[model samples]
Target: MQFTSGYGAEPGAWRLPGANLRSYTDMDQFVRYAQAAERGKIQLLFFADTPVLDVDLERQVPHFAIDPLLVMTSIARETERIGLVSTASTTFNEPYSLARQFKALDVISHGRAGWNAVTTSDPAAAANFGRAVPPRAEKYERAHEVLQIVQALWGSWEKDAWVLDVDGKRFADMDRIQPVDLQGRHVASRGPLPIPPSEQGQPVIFQAGGGGYGLELAGRYADGVYANPYTIEDGQAQRQALRDAAERAGRDPDEVKMFAGFMPAIAGSRRAALDRRRFLDESVDLRQRVRYLGAMIGLPLGYRQIDEPLTADQLADAVPSPHDPRSARALEVAREGWTLRDVLAHGVIDYHPVVAGTATDVADHMQQWFEAGACDGFSLAIDGYHDGVDAFVDQVVPLLQERGLFHLDYEGPTLRDHLHAREQYGLDPRVTETAAR
Candidate 1:
């Protein structure tokens, strides 16, 4: 199965109970983490970025402080096999510029670069770009256009376009270069990208979003998907839905790999792991939890007592912010006439399924999900900088390898090669073609 390290250096990442790691801002720690992941043969080191500050700056880590692509560039020289994926917003960036940057990264990394496509969701980012936030539909519409233009630009230079002929005094074949004269309702671009395609084609595209619009975009163009499925059943349904959408889009379903998020708190034994989980869970302050609940519901719940039962009227008064996708979950709970404590009890707010156990126990859960066709692999969410990742690499990876559920060594170079390696494992070919049936 494909393995990706979802670097958790952002604000709330450090707030988990029992977390004693240093700040993610420490470059030394970050580099060490990347090296450890590479040693474990993780396929991708994925970074989640925001164009503007969206969280409480005083309480949370500012994600925008460092540009992910630049950081990836630094890591590129330190490792050879692991893939580097960076997030870029179609809403805030022009297609041509984004294309050029990724092309450069792909070249520098020898075709191991990936771009995580995102239409900026934080309304505050609009101000940074000096514009009002567009409606959700409009943002996605623009994103679709942006993607087309970027792909066109990346294809502008044909293979073998570059010819260094000393006798002819020629640098490139003019006939082979073509302009991408594109004009759509939301975007327009006319150009041939200056950079040619890297050794492995354009940087692999990764996309993440919630709801239908997001899924449709991923189905149409993404090579890999960072999905949010909180249950095994939910994961199965989402994977099937993505494949169905791919069929309708006239794309090969197997080409689109689905990666569900996973965070494991492992120890020597299952009981010890449970104890660690309890410590971490209890470490989270009530105020912070209430604030998170407010963000999910799109309104503050600070005034209400933690144990107070929420009324429909109170919920109805608190309208969901158009930008936050998780607001739907809070609304669902409020509609059920549940108490504030119920929201905390269900743990419905987390993006991924958390598994707490021994290495074998964790491996068993992962095996069950994979065999059940829940996802192509997992994007591991780390709790600590060094300790968290090191534990899994040392303990969990060997178990997965022993079970023949994961790769023993580097299969091939390039992110595309790593993603396509799944075909060799005898996965059901029909998994991606389920929509046709």
Candidate 2:
């Protein structure tokens, strides 16, 4: 799931005819999306979060308005099997608090919770905490230390710590519970988490971010990786890199699943899908499109003609803005000689690859990537919210299931069971089900 709101991955999604603008704050909207994904036996519904109001709300609808964990909690009650994952920044939050919250969520969901650890780069989020944004190196370093503390906290309480001895009149075992006392360069914690492990043990750890320090953190701790790769080849290389990193950290490489982010625009036919993409592309007003294009290339383009070709010098001068790290992808498209209009039409502002096609077409693309070692699966986003999820679940999922590439039903009750679904796809020879640590 891209979001639990009306506005999806498409920037102009809210402007579509009959779009529900009120769904952003409505709890029922999230329940609908979660139930729909559950019907398809989708492994998980992921929600991305930013603590600050980062977008220009006057122009674009803010997607990260509500707390994702709170929303996921509501969804967790409404749905039975689908996994619920939410982003929580390691940079700004305390390790013990986040660890406790996620553990409680896991217990509440009966082991269907996942936490996406991120080193948030948004400077506005830093301002909310009355601190300047830390440098890239420092942020990742802190993230490493924080994750260590959180993991230790999660494991503090032994499986049998909460004992109920009716005959003996003793209800607990103090010796079984241990305190975590770890001191790192950036953070330290001393505690035994009050919450014990849930049915599947601790919540699955997912790491989001891509280069150097990010890979190291994921390799050491994450059971899954959330990634954005613009091309299949890039995805394949990233998978190999993650696997290598895991192996270097003395963990099983295959245990670290990479879910590359992809947004698909699906319809009954290929031409219709393309037309839907076009409709979404033209939904935004020209001025807003110009602003978006300018933001993508880090330039002021309100004065420039929309159809005019950007010069080589202009493309060369383009650099990533402080807030938007995806600007480079747009510049890459512009350097290929696309006009400003063409760039926006191609949706270059988003770093995730988009597929506009029929159900079969989408299924074929996913199958090819999986077979080619590009990714274990995708972190799917939609062209629209409710309709987009229904279209894929109704249309594309059956095709994948028919081809034996996906599970027809969930193999187990926990999120880890769904992820490590044994004997389902047979894509990896080493695939196995192991309890979460």
Candidate 3:
């Protein structure tokens, strides 16, 4: 499972701010967290973004985090080897600015940066962006167009575009760097972006939309996928589907890595793990529980009971995860009576999987899934405060290293180099340059 640092607003943490990070009011604190994770040889540091604030998560949950990109900019200067990922929404932001920001990050980080492509789904985001309501099918189309434009911009400067011609008194060969005449359906542009292609070419693409169109688009282009994995069997099945889709889309399936969002709450003993699990289950407020349940089942906000029997239809309706309106997810949770506590307790099942146990046990589950080809890795979305990340890095991570399942130290300087160390960087050099119009 891929570990992600969100959900908590933790204070007094050394490595990462816990899920509830409301207490961490320091800007430099985020930098400290990223630096510490790098010391652990953690592979990737990721963040997610929303165009607008909705459901009053801060009022509901413990804390709300900062802008992922800005935080990563600080990380770019302070850390090395650890892959830095930023989440950006194509729905609200323009492609040009988004492309430029990610490119600049890639350059400053020495290619340790990646962009998680997303479509803004929150209703409040629509309001924030001058839309009365969210657009459904159109958003995916816009994302596709945005991806196309961004890639072209990244490729605008050819490998030899900036050869200095001192004798000729020229800075670059204009012929080598050409505009990309991209007439997008929703988003379009001309480019050879102001910045040349960085050492890593461009930041890697990470995707998480689970719908068919989103999966196909990601399959065609993304380097990694951030996904929700319930069971090992389910993850394997999803992996297979992604592989098949890649084949159909005429891309190499191996090019994309899977980082399932998982919540593994580790403890020294089975009893301790269980106790921690219980505390988490009972800790959440009850109304939030109803909202969470409705969200999960894709039902509208309404009445539900704790002991209410879940129906096949209700469960089926809720099973389809919503990408845009939190309302759809909220409705499902409430109508089905999936309380906040249950939502938190289920972890990866209804929630992302939360593994609560000793280091050995937690590593065992991670290994089982890895060897099974269910996922390449997991992004941990551990519970609040600092204990969750602390235990993971100190306990579970060490075991993974001992088993040779994870890296004891980073192999390369760049995120792309580290992720695909043995792979060729110029594998698609020709794909990098399209003549300017």
Candidate 2 is scored at a TM of 0.84
**Local lDDT at 359 for model 1:** 79
Report the candidate with higher TM-score, 1 versus 2: 2
Candidate 2's C-alpha runs over 4 A off are 4-6, 282-349, 421-437
The residue-by-residue lDDT of candidate 2 on 1-437, one tens digit each, is 65735567776777767767777888888788779989999999888888888777777777673888888898888998999888999999999899899989999999899889999888889899888889999999898778878877887887877888999887878797788888888788898888877877888888888789999888877888998876678889999999998877766788889998887888877567756766777646767877877876677777366778787667667775656545666677677776676666556665687667788888888898888989999999887875888888999899999999999899899988988821211012121111122
Q: How close is candidate 3 to the true structure, as a TM-score?
A: 0.78
Give the winner by TM-score: 2 or 3.
2
Candidate 3 lDDT score at position 279: 61
Q: Identify the runs in model 3 with alpha carbons over 4 angstroms from their true place.
A: 1-25, 61-64, 132-135, 164-169, 274-283, 287-350, 421-437
Model 3, span 241-302: residue lDDT tens: 88776666656778778887666667778667655665655534556655555565555534
Clash count, predicted structure 3: 43
Residue 190, model 1, lDDT = 91
Candidate 2 clashing pairs? Answer: none
Candidate 1 at residue 4, lDDT?
A: 19
Clashing pairs in model 1, backbone N/Cα/C closer than 3 A: 11-61
TM-score of each model, in listed order: 0.79, 0.84, 0.78
lDDT of each candidate versus the true structure: 0.73, 0.79, 0.66
Instruction: Say which candidate scores most in lDDT.
Output: 2
Looking at candidate 2, what is the lDDT of residue 241?
96
